[model samples]
Target: MESEALGHTVMDQRQGHGSLVAVAEKLTLEEINSTGAISNFGKPNAPSPAAIVACVPKNVHVDEVGETEFRISPSEITAAIKAGLDFGGAYRC
Candidate 1:
């Protein structure tokens, strides 16, 4: 509900504004895997955050984000997103 309300307020200001649009073709799993993250894992069901952790700049205080880091699983993220959706309205297909 809050995010939707914010979106409505922003739309009111935009009115008739137009923005640049970019389209990208769908990429195949083979193409995505060719980049190397899953090149060894076989077909990854979903990209793992840990796979690219090395790319992130080494943090001297990485422990600051300890609990919120890799410990949280994808199921938890999905559940949180679903809970937020429930606050807006009963989700109806």
Candidate 2:
């Protein structure tokens, strides 16, 4: 549903540039729930660690898993950057 809304916004922007001149003003927390695309489609009540791990590479290296620390493989950083690029919007918030 979040993607659908983004798609609609994109379409609207294409049709009328004036409609979304200030894109930030158009965004709302309601549209970015854990289930929203902004959360990478995660359901509500999910953790940041889990979300971060999801962005890790397929061949991730887990040196240790602790409550406050995570030792992800180098590839994890690459994957996270790729994910950001793939989903980044023109609008800055």
Candidate 3:
């Protein structure tokens, strides 16, 4: 798999250097709701990209992945979903 290959590459580079660690924590439903990105009204509110990003926890430490770690954030996922929706809408147009 691509990820396994990437991990091997990272391990190679960090060999005999020191221990490298990466932590990924799943977001709880409560945490997502606490972001206020969702509304209590019958209709849902569209959250700004910044607001979505704000909801993501930064406690996870990633090693040797460069900036690719940002891809896992809530905001990035939301943006990707929105883009997919937009593409689907365009196809319907």
Candidate 4:
């Protein structure tokens, strides 16, 4: 696997269903959006001034089986909430 090539070990495995778990050394926030952004798409009230969260190192666990799961940090969750609030504020007129 690509993760194995990157020096991550398979901490756990499951049979019957193909699944593996690995730890990522770093991660970043890619995007943020709110319901208003979706509803206002291609409209005048659409949100602008995209909020860019800079890339930062985040340690997280990655579980890949049928679907991908990311075990993220509490700080990451806080950052996401803050970003959502910012997106909502900008989404409103």
The lDDT for every candidate, in the order shown, is 0.44, 0.51, 0.48, 0.50
Where does candidate 2 stray beyond 4 Å?
Answer: 1-69, 89-93
In model 2, residue pairs whose N, Cα or C atoms come closer than 3 Å (at least 3 residues apart or on different chains), thus clashing, are: none
Candidate 3, residue 75: how far the Cα is off, in Å: 0.1
Say what the RMSD of model 4 is. 17.5
lDDT of 4 at 25: 27
Model 1 stretches with alpha carbons more than 4 Å out:
1-70, 90-93
> How many clashes does each candidate structure show, in the order listed?
0, 0, 0, 0
Position 90, candidate 3: lDDT: 21
TM-score of 2: 0.24
lDDT string for model 4 (1-90, tens) is: 977898966544363234312322232222233434464433468565354345544454445644344465768765785677667644
Pairs that collide, model 3:
none
TM-score of each: 0.24, 0.24, 0.23, 0.24
Native-referenced Cα lDDT, model 2? 0.51
Local accuracy of candidate 2 as per-residue lDDT tens digits, 57-89: 345444584244345666877576557656763
lDDT of 1 by residue, 1-93 (tens): 876876754444344343212212455555554654332322236443443222323333456554333345567665765575556532322
Q: What is the lDDT of residue 50 in candidate 1?
A: 48
lDDT of 3 by residue, 1-93 (tens): 876875754455565344433311455556655654343222246433433233455455568654433336566675776676555532221
